[model samples]
Target: MGGNELPLQRIEPVSVSGRGLPRWLRRTSGPVALVLLWHILSVTGVLPSEVLAGPSTVLSSAATLIETGELQEAMWVSLSRALTGLAIGGSIGVTLAVIAGLFRLGEDLVDATMQMMRTVPNVALIPLLIIWFGIGEAPKIALIALGTAFPLYLNVYAGIRNVDQSLIEVGRTLGLSRLAMIVNVVLPGALPSALVGLRYSLGIAWLALVFGEQINATAGIGYLMANAREFFQTDVIVVCLVVYALLGLGVDFTVRTLEKVFLSWRPAFNGT
Candidate 1:
């Protein structure tokens, strides 16, 4: 082969923009466009009415709901539940993860229970929780905490348990105290895994929110969707679903950004 023909050139791929927007539009791509196309076609009377109502009708319905401030109120209600539940659950989860990592007795006592709880659907707890707690924020928060706790405990426990014993021995040889060794070595070593637990726990928090808001809630996004269903307003349900999807994406983004910031010293593939 000639020198130039010895090897062909390779071109790096350039990602395309979708939905007349950036490629990062994520789940909004094909479905949103399809919905819009359906709406355009339907409103122009180009399609059979038996199939679906198009975008313009949905938009007008959405606009009407927004104008009455119901959407805003429902959004705020849902946001509040999600945020509060996250804070409470995440705090308990991380704390427990840390403690479980540090204490063998605690790990043994709680591991089995948490493993069992992990299998129990967070939503199933709603009925019992409503019965016991009367469908208040307390039960919802507890549910969120329950949903979030296990991953954190597992990661953190693994982090602490799997610490290099040699490192501890070196610290001992260096005459470092137990607390100092743990603080200086164990914590830093375990941080990446712990943060991963925290990140995954955020998704669980949202899942718990959906269930929590379903019981005795007159305000949350879930409640709005529930009420909308009675009126056969499919678009309103879609709006709530879109909000949840966006929120989850936003939270995952935040967690990843934090990982980049806090765990910068750890190599990419070096996770626990």
Candidate 2:
């Protein structure tokens, strides 16, 4: 047989792997390409001048702010506020979720009130927060906490309540105490859901920063955006927004990595 004429039966299929790149990045490439195209159009004057800012302009503004330490200071303030609020809101939300999930009356008592609060926008409460806490870090943190609490509460509550009855029965049959069952069975079952809630609450805390900056005297990405808005500095605004997006992505990625590392028992984190 000629060397070039290899039989199909003799050859094993060589699989080409999409390794060295995350599946998410691969999936998002299409949208990123479109964004690049839009950016190019904006730079070339194809898009409306007022509505869209060129990437270069935004990058230049960001570089200037970074060089001047404005970006760093703003990032510190915003991240501090976000983390503090997340701690407070997440703690309370998880506490309430545990209480409500354990006791039926707790859910009944809190549900309607939480529903009412959920309907109320964090921005709307700014005036009242100012009156109560003054124009300080307290009010800003409180606002973020308020915005963050509901999502965590909802998700954690569902997680707790949705724990498999069969698992509970199995624990009971095994002669496990109530607390033991909760720790071993209920909490584990609910952990994945609670993680989802945690990630979501973190996002909401960031979102509430918009309302926080409007009232607060100074500092934070939100403040930067507000200041940029006043001067019609669209590039600065865009830069701050881009930073916010990156920070959110960073936080989410950290959370996801933690979940994968710690909760490997769950199929959701099987690396498949």
Best by lDDT: 2
Model 2 pairs whose backbones collide: none
Candidate 2, residues 48-70: lDDT per residue as tens digits?
55776787777888899999999
What tens digits encode model 1's per-residue C-alpha lDDT throughout 193-245?
Answer: 88788777888878888888777777878888788778777767767887787
TM accuracy, model 1: 0.76
Error in Å for residue 34 of model 1? 6.1
RMSD of each: 6.2, 4.6
